[model samples]
Target chain A: MLNYLWGAMIFIGILVAAFTGNMAEVTNGAVNSAKEAVTVCITMLGVMSMWTGIMKIGEEAGIIRSMSKGLRPLLKWLFPSVPEDHRAMDHIATNVIANFLGLGWAATPAGLMAMEELQSLNKHKERASNAMCMFMIFNMSSLQLVSINIIAYRTQYGSANPSEIIGPGIITTLVSTAAAIAFAKAAEAAS
Target chain B: MRAISVLSDLILPLVIVYILSCGYSKKINVYEVFIEGAKEGFKIVMDILPTLIGLMMAVGILRSGGTLELISRAVSPIVRRIGFPPEAVPISLMRLVSSSASTGILLDIFKNYGPDSFIGRFVSVMMSCTETVFYTMSVYFMSVKVTKTRYTLAGALAANVAGIAASLTLCQYLWG
Candidate 1:
């Protein structure tokens, strides 16, 4: 899927640039974006490392376990296919918590681990399960309690009140999350 | 808003203190475990570097080639009918596929219209309210080797649409 999407993007970009006589801009964009990608990763590394280290202490100290325990009822409701005591639930809870806190860099590792754990429980090797689908929906539209990135950007751009959007952000994300959960549940029932 | 900002600032410190205290009480070597987790985090970043680079380049070409502008123009009429500023069309569209590209668009909007402007606030809210659907789907499914996504994409895109609609409506109601 990604292969085809990536190929088409590059191909169509070059073709369009040729017709538009903007090949030079395209060349510069490609080079600059490639460099930007590395810079982005390097920036992410510091945040990711710090959060993951704290999360490690959290896990070792059983904070994560307690967090998962508190989240069990909700997790069970969301992923009925997975057993209540499964490790995937813990990872899912951690991922969702990280996402809710607007710690996307910290969420990826736990989200990946959750997917892997869910995959292991799958009877079908190549196909994703209903639980996995629901998890993805929730993660994608996860309710953000605080959007640190947007606030930071607003501050950088010289907004008078950088955090004013928190109210609207929370409301919008809640709406999206509700929509995602409803859609996923409907799809699950239909199938 | 000030209260929320203060709370957000305290979250990191609170988490760190809680974790360290818990680890101490539990008689665990917090430093070693933290290093182990940090190593895993570094590994994960390394693993995703190639994918990130590929996506960035694709997004760059699409933006520079003027395809995004064309699409934005094509969608402007409908978007305008819905009361969303036509300038936001590009950001909303690119947002589904690439975070950085959409961010670039948002910065442009902020530059043209100051961050306190209606359109600027709308874009900021939208950015916070949504996720990069294609990027998340690709990276996650690829990591798990799930070739058959089985409605995950549909669900995510649906949520993205909901997010955009909600942001637009909320922004108008609250700030317009």
Candidate 2:
């Protein structure tokens, strides 16, 4: 991690020198890029707020609870160590649900709380348990439903159809999540 | 030309050649295909609503609870010394909360200060490659009830370092 940090610093330093040599263009492009990013971010906030509202409605309508019910079986398979009545299951459901909708912002705390709960169950204090490994793997490669940020970026970059990455995003996530899961399970077996 | 461009961009010409060899029908409607593709995106958003909300509320609670400050303080000095700005600290913390939100905020940062600024480059690169690993792992682990691992923090932080490196190098090379 420290190595990467140093590399980034060195890289940025060179970029600074290069841009300074051509002050006119670099400054202009940087300004334009920043401007575009702000516009896109503003638009994204609107989208995020709208989704957040809709999700609230879903919760009020019992939609989320029902969805979690459906996910329970799969959760059981993935986390057999957890007792049937554990709160961790609920947290997992919520976490997966958030990822499914590309509402990653919403999922952070639930992820943490879930980890705390899971930690309570751990017998070992120094090493990560198998379940911990599995959980990390899944989270790392969690499938995204919206990929909204990328779309916004594409728009910022002047792509004709900024949302066009959705198909590829879905495909890539599916592949990555499956790979992450496979590796995690394999590790569990070896351990 | 439009149809050719869409088909060429999305699928390999060899596949098109195979379809043609197989006596496939004449030209397809590019607009229709595009719409169909976009509709799939809408469906995905619809399908994930509950999870998104629960996750958000949980994060909202954590934020309200002031956990981000604690996490930020621990990582601040290292990030700052690397030429990343102090303001970027919260955004990076938010990233552990959510990527889209983080990106949205990054845009705000970029607006206030150009992307070429020391901070802007670091944040942008951080945005490009890093996943919200800590938040995701925290939730997943908590849900399953298997805790007590230190490697997760290490691995995730390491990944962020790599992402920062990649972003900085690429942006400087391409935009700088």
Candidate 3:
């Protein structure tokens, strides 16, 4: 799926640029954007390391376990395919907590771990399970308690009230999370 | 709202204190554990670097080639009816595809219209509220080596659209 999307994007970009005589801009964009990607990751490295370290402390101290215990009921409801004692639940909880804090870079490792654990439980090796789909939906639409990245951008841009959008951000994400859960449930039912 | 804001502000400090105290009570080597996790974090960054570069380059090419503008113009009428500014069409379109690219678009919007401006605030909310659906799905699925992602993309994209709608609507009610 992503393979097709990537191919189409590059193909259409070059074709359109050629027709519009914007090939120079395309060339520049490719180089600059690739550099931008590295720069973005470098910026993310600090935050990711900090949060993941703290989360590691949390994990070693059993905070993550307690947190996962707190979320057990709801998570169980969300992912029926995953068992109660499964390691995937812990990973899922960690991912959800990281996402809620708006630590997306920190969340990816846990999210990947969750997917890998869930995959281990799958009978069909090639196909994604319902639990996997639900987990993806929740991770993708995870409600953020603090949008640190956007706030950082706002402050950098010199906004007088950098946090003003926090209210709308929370509300909008809550709505989207509800929608994601509902869509996942519907999709699961259909499948 | 004020209480929530305060709590949000305190979350970092609270988490840090809680973790430190918990580690202390457990007599765990917090520093060593933290360094280990940090190393893993760097490894995670290295793992995703290629995907990030590919996604960014693709999105950048599309944007620079004027494909996004063309698509934005085509979608303007419907977007206008939903009360979103035409300028935000690109951000919304790119939000699901690549987060860094969307941030770049957001910075452009902020520069053009001050961050305090309605469009700027709207785009900020939109960007904060939504996830990079395709990028996330690809990375996650790739990690698990799941070639047949059944309904994950559809579900995520649906959620993204919902987020975009809610962002536009809430921004209008709160800040418009």
Candidate 4:
């Protein structure tokens, strides 16, 4: 009852916004928001580019592969469905690493690429595979260790110690990932 | 000085160019496109300005009508019992509602109190970890046509619980 109620609340909220001449406003907001989003995207570009360059450097330096190799055991545990040597696992590893640094913008493309590779491995069309479910769960939980966007916002708003959130970010993500993984496995088991 | 001035002008708008390039190819003249896009952008701003005002008013009502205050008050005891300072309650609640806006508010708190301040650090941790569960669930479920699911609600709420707990623990230990 409560589930349906909350769903209705959201549906109705979007509906009401659409009906009450707020559609124009909503559309406008979406566009304006898009513009602002563009600005933000731009702002993040250099940051992402820097990180991507660094990641590339790391890759060339064999650091990323080593990190992925080291993370293999844990990644295998977290994603039991993916073959350890699968290309999807590598993309997932890169995606997870990028996300941990709070590089959401960077992580997104990597995540999509990971999903595409994962999909290639999927034989079922109607029902999601275990890998798909785990991917979605992990993406939603998004184990952010640095929370770069928040730090950027802090800097934008004149924060004196914008980088201070890193510790908490790391801790919270570790906890959230553990919980998410546990719940996801439980759901898989129940199903 | 001339080179410095030229370089400075180039620096700020770099973000502008990079953003436009993301959705489109590099071959296009980004500056011209951005300029052309600004009119539509301005129109969008004008259109949404009223709604933005309304949203702000709604937020203002929550703030001034004392509902927000009451919520913080109600949650304070529970949070305090877990070792978080009372100041974290409001910010945590707000973060659940909207991350971008909460980021602004969190920045203000960080600025005023210093990031190492107990409450500031707690809020920081909270900001880093949590998603806007209510908003995301609402949007995702609606889009996906999921009209029934008690477990989904429970699941989302559970994620929030884990987030908050981790936030408290980390802030108290490492940042404490």
Worst 10 residues of 2 chain A by lDDT: A1-10
- Docking quality band of candidate 2, CAPRI definitions: incorrect
Flag the better candidate by lDDT, 2 or 3.
Answer: 3
Candidate 1 residue pairs in clash (backbone atoms < 3 Å) = none
lDDT of each residue in A126-149, candidate 3, tens digit only: 999999989998888856766666
TM-score-superior candidate, 3 or 4? 3
**How does model 1 do on interface RMSD, in angstroms?**
5.0
Per-residue alpha-carbon lDDT of candidate 3 for residues B48-82, written as tens digits (9 for 90 to 100): 67877887788778878877677778888987885
lDDT of 3: 0.79
Local accuracy of candidate 2 as per-residue lDDT tens digits, A43-151? 5454444444444433334444666899998788878898978998888778777766655555667667667667777788546766666666677664455455554
Which stretch of 10 consecutive residues in model 3 chain A shows the poorest summed lDDT? A148-157
Residues A35-86, candidate 4, lDDT per residue (tens digit)? 4444443444444444333333333334435556777888888777788888
- Give the winner by DockQ: 3
Which 10-residue span in candidate 4 chain A carries the lowest summed lDDT?
A51-60
Local accuracy of candidate 2 as per-residue lDDT tens digits, B1-176: 24423532564334324323332233444334434434443454444443333333333322323333344567778875764555667676566656544654565455455554555545654554456775556555555544565455554554454445544544444334
Error of 1 at B123 (Å): 1.3
Question: Which parts of model 1 have CA positions greater than 4 angstroms off?
Answer: A1-63, B1-73
